[model samples]
Target: MDHISREVDRTQELAGVMSKIEMNHRAFCFANVKDAKFPLVGGLYNSLERFGDALGHNGPEPFTHADFDGRIEAAKAEPIQPLTVDSGLTKENVITGDAINLHDLPVPTFFELDSGPFITGAIGVTRDPGSGELNIGIYRTLIIDRNHFVINASSMSDLRRIYSSWEATGETMPIAIALGVPPAMLIGGSCKLPPNMCEFGVAGALAGEPIQLVKCEDSDLLAPADAEIVIEGTVNFSNRVENLLGEFAGQYGPEDAPVTQVNTITHRNDAMFYSIVAGRHPEHNTLGNVAVYGVQRSIAASIREVAPEVIDLEVLLEPAMGTLAHVVVSIDKHSDAQPRDIIERIFAASGNIFPVSKITKRIIVVDDDIDVHDPVDVRWAVWNRAATETKFMVIPGIESWELERAAKAGQKSVRIGIDATMDLEDIDKLLRPIIPGIDEINLEDYLD
Candidate 1:
């Protein structure tokens, strides 16, 4: 419940207080922003429980029943509904031309080495040039001046490809940056869907309803109608140097991206600007798990194709391991060779969006008894059951993630695979000790 003051430069203060709140698993707000009319809110998605609740799954084991595969399939099969042009965005305030000043916003600089204040929570809305399919994604935007900023899209991102297409045609790409959008849209925008897929439809499927949209004041691009703030602009083809931003991997990521010219800024009367604390904090890491949902499903599908004995798969998004770097699989295998084969197949597996081989750094295979979701249980199985000679594997000279610290000159690195299941010959000797009727015992009754 910390209340930030309206100091001239509260960036450092906000970052310091945010760090404290994250460690304590609490949410806080900036009741007073220095130059902005709206307050800034953060830490809404700091924990898995909070994230699950935001997604409207309040039941026990929310993520287990999220059904990402079903939602993705539905999005692909269903046609996207037309965006509704609502007047909510301009009902209260609208700034255009020279009146559009980015300095009025409460964007924060989270780290000492950070280039400047960045907008980490806004979803960029654009469309594919050829197909006219809608595309939405979260891209880090660096505010340059009063009405200018650079939007950083990674080389592999769809926005980059779309920008290239627009550049080839010598046309300025129209884009809209929507802040404080629905949680479902945030999750949908983060997913790596096929080029033909519409993230708006995916968002609709996720929320069991279509998201309301508003046409941008300056461009034809549509943004979330209920968004707290929307910046309407067109992409400038000129490349801009974006030095660094503290990323979820607990490291600084630098990039060069195209600049954007803001034409219009619109918001609600009582708008509340949303910000995700940048860096390797809880909110940053937990919110990043949304991006792994699609990858996990793709990996599971690939593993099942080669090894039908696979029971469960868990892709760990823990900050230390980085996002989607570590994967644990539980399987009922018939032979010792299955684990190695599964590992190779997974590394070779082509994902629906991005290649699985490119993202996974470590793969661990365990027996059905092991809970792949529990890191402690997985480590215990690896320590006690893995054979020194046959259970470990290393594949060298593989292309690793660009942000991985250990990546080589060309981003090439080694991948590790571990078979943590019990040896087929010593199954009886490796049984875990259990207390009888432990699940039926109630600690509350005994306490009384």
Candidate 2:
């Protein structure tokens, strides 16, 4: 829920944050866990591997396995499983009498640097008190008092706009938050949907069926059919220092963001709470790569010429740096023309990636053959394929994910760019000399 935090009220969103303390990123379904050799702690860890199946480049079973088809597919594969009841958790629908309370749930403290333990993946559906137009944003909520939280939202976000309008009059905006909608709904909440597009509707489209939602308690807003939990609240932007917490970005964000007062909380009888590992993406946060993969087709189209060889893009969440920082590119540069230009273009092309990468020196670009999704593979390319003189280039500083001094002024850095292609001078000769026995082995069988 790094992309949006109100959705944090749900089970999966909570799972992303709680996974940190728990250190478990397994999927909701057993099949995903059953098939892969390695366990997945976060959602959509590697876009390249999953993208292969999504685009018909691979088989449909893997797509289903990776949940590329999303919530509807998940439901189809496993069917509707009901949540039970509990004082802390529940199975009650949003519209029911049980749909009340902004407390009683174990919301997570997602990051070390956060001002407080913040709820990572909650989808807040707030209505413009005056206009009454519904706006859905995935915003992070930091619990300050049982009644309030600090919402980290940008001026560009719908929540910010709607809440700001309320703050102009010293009034609070009404909000509804839901947890554990279909995975597609969470992705949609994080996605750059069209203006006035109901994320719930987009979620349904992604699922290949209309998402079943129930009316939220004490509000006109609606939540998912099988939501594990839901929260309702109001916020006054004028409230200061409400939640002066650290954030997923591994730095202290200004508590001046705004304050949210949660009045009521509700959930299914036996609701399942979720937690996400806050700080990273490759192996930590899901928001960056989720968005990267979420928008790859769009990004691919946007920078087609600038980054043509980029058959894929993956956001490697650096554990040291939180989400939004340290994005690695797997470029398929066919020409000698400045591939750095592609990196520069893509650095700007991505939506949330720009600001975090500003301080960083380089957007490391490895060849398509190198699995950008794998740190070991990318590291290997940096050693062998990278020529300090020929492979890397410098670019002026902009907002970057570089944890170092890249974003700071006078901190120009030569971004290392590797033209790791077969196009390189007889690079194939240098390839790991495959011995007969080792090369002949069926690695896929072993992988299975």
Identify the candidate with maximal TM-score: 1
Worst 10 residues of 2 by lDDT: 30-39
TM-score: model 1 vs. ground truth: 0.87
Candidate 2: lDDT of 192?
Answer: 51
Off by over 4 Å in 1: 6-8, 51-83, 205-209, 330-336, 423-448
What total of clashing residue pairs does each candidate reach?
0, 73
Pairs that clash in candidate 1: none
- Candidate 2 lDDT over residue span 1-448, tens digit each: 2232232432344444434433333232211221112112234333434333333344444443245525333333432322222223222433333433334445545444456556665677776666565566677677775566776765336666666677787764667777655555665566554455455655555555666665555666665657666777766656666444444455544435666666566666655554344544332344444444433434334445456666665543343543333446776555655465666676555443233234233356766667777878777877776654656554443443323422455543333334443335646665765466875788788884
Best model number under lDDT: 1
How well does candidate 2 score on lDDT at residue 253?
Answer: 48
Give all candidates' CA lDDT scores.
0.79, 0.51
- Please give the TM-score that candidate 2 achieves against the real structure: 0.60
How well is each residue in 140-230 modelled by candidate 1, as lDDT tens digits?
9998899889888975579989988999999879988888888778878887877868788878866777778877777777888888999
